[model samples]
Target: MTDQRPQYGELATPEEQRRAAGLPPLGEIPPVPPMMQLSAPEPVAQAPNPGRSRPVDRFVTIGLLAYGLVNVVITGLSYLDLPTVMNESMKILGIDGEFSNFAQGKLWGTIAAALLVIGWALTAALAIKRLRRGKVAWWVPLVGAVVTMAVVSACIAVPMFNDPAFMAYLEQMSGG
Candidate 1:
């Protein structure tokens, strides 16, 4: 408080002040222009509603979530009746083979179900994030659907592939 020099822990806002404090200019700084009449800031093209979503975006979110809910309910019911369906189909096809590891198939079904729900949630989250940021988000759900179905299909195939008679029939049909 006695001298005109800076005290400890004081920030150097000006280049001259920084130089006086034995500090070099941090980096390339535009040279200061002479004082002139102030002007309004350059008009920035602003968003219609920053950080606020539109009706369409909300509709997309809700519609897809409802779609996911219906899918979960129906697919869950199918999985619950999977064993009976397998037996019936096998009888109709005249295949005498049984499931070697029904527990393993159950595990795969669980994994597929979990992945399907997680994929839907993740897709919605990504779309919402981009929509909030005022970005084009129409493609997210499509891509998510493709990838999620591919993964779920692969997971669901394990159980069917575990049947030896099915594999033998496939091999016979393939000219092997």
Candidate 2:
């Protein structure tokens, strides 16, 4: 018997055949206008302002940076004299000259002071950078300031409270 069924490709209409061939139907697509044929115009480039910080923020940042630098310097100077201070403190407590113990205490005290100063300086620097970047979070600098004050106060207060001389001075000053 002869085969009578249409071939698979030939079963589609002309338009479907055109689409199946990955082409548009004749007279279907419109030509691009001459204006669109040209390349698109380049976008304008804008220069970002590097000095974008406001006056108040700039002032606060500068202050914080200065405070950090001062803390670093003072802490360094204090560390340099730490051995002498420790010896005197030991003498005040009626302790005999034991260089090894004094040296160990001074070493630990210096390390603690260095860490505290470095941490405070870093926090201040970060807050200054954030402020300069136009961030509005006031708490960044505030927290740094508070922590710095607390650290300094603790460093000063602990020795004063422990030392008989300092406590006596305070008592004399207070008339008690």
Candidate 3:
């Protein structure tokens, strides 16, 4: 209504203001180039399906857990007889040294031994199940368990073996 130039907000519509300003009227923005066209969308690779474990495999896992529990109990018992356990271990391993009460923390040492036995049992159960399922190489868990058990035993046994006192005790027990 006024002779003065209308500022931006004073215009009835942006298009009217743009036109009055001697600028091109605003129109719908031209469609953007489709993202797919601009650049090939990296083909989304679907995640791979991890196959389910067979029933036997599940049973084996349970068995392993049981074995592990057993080992834990054994290790706990071992702590109640630390000196004897250490000396016996050393003798079994044929290690020639005296490991005193001050040498190691009995609890952790025993736990390590227990866990080894349990881990082995679980591995063996898994292997046997696999074998029964017609897996060609069946001895996997058995061998693993055996080796683990031996290593765990040796870890505790070596020190016992090395102790002369332990050996003397063994001899006396055998009535030698």
Candidate 4:
């Protein structure tokens, strides 16, 4: 014999329970409306292959990383040559002089090189993290370069301004 107990949902009303028990309706009780249709809501639109390839963002991020690599190498090479650094630092200051503090100037160059390397590494790491998370990361390298170079510029400035020649030139210009 078929079991009369409710087979499924616990929300069965008294009438449903009774119907499951196969009792005739007492005094014309209205039939329970058919259970509401429950289909899954339309699936959220997702980016194509969210678990797979995100090629465009990856390409741009890598390209930007390559650009940063080139810049860091060129800047490091420039800082390696002391004569060029001496001339260029003065040139940047608009002064016809060389830094007498060769050791101190080289120290600044070293600091700049370190900053460039560190900045490149950090940008690469951040970009890789973003790419893995499927985020746009093309701008990280550019922003990293801008921030690192600003600090490097300040580092270069300290020795430049501390030089007697640079200070004299500034005094000469300011009429002090």
Best-matching candidate per TM-score: 4
Q: What are the models' TM-scores?
A: 0.58, 0.45, 0.38, 0.64
lDDT agreement with native, every candidate = 0.70, 0.61, 0.59, 0.77
> Which of candidates 3 and 4 reaches a greater TM-score?
4
* Candidate 1 per-residue lDDT over residues 88-123, each given as its tens digit: 666787777755557756778778778888888888
- Candidates sorted by TM-score, descending order? 4, 1, 2, 3
Task: Assess candidate 4 and give its TM-score to the true structure.
Answer: 0.64
How well does candidate 4 match the true structure, expressed as C-alpha RMSD?
A: 10.0
lDDT of 2 by residue, 33-150 (tens): 8856674677554333325646566666677667666766776577556656655665776554422334444555566577667666677767756665566534565677577667
Given candidate 3, what's the lDDT at residue 48? Answer: 29
Candidate 3 lDDT tens digits, 102-150: 3543644665556665666567566656545544323464466567767
The CA lDDT at 29 in model 3 is: 48
In model 1, the clashing pairs are: none
Query: What residue pairs clash in candidate 4, if any at all?
Result: none
TM-score of 2: 0.45
Q: How many backbone clashes does candidate 4 have?
A: 0
Candidate 4, residues 1-176, lDDT tens digits: the string is 98787554477877776777787656576655453234335655443542357677678779989988998999877866544676776788688777776777788878888888998999899988877667777788889888888988887777777788888898999999
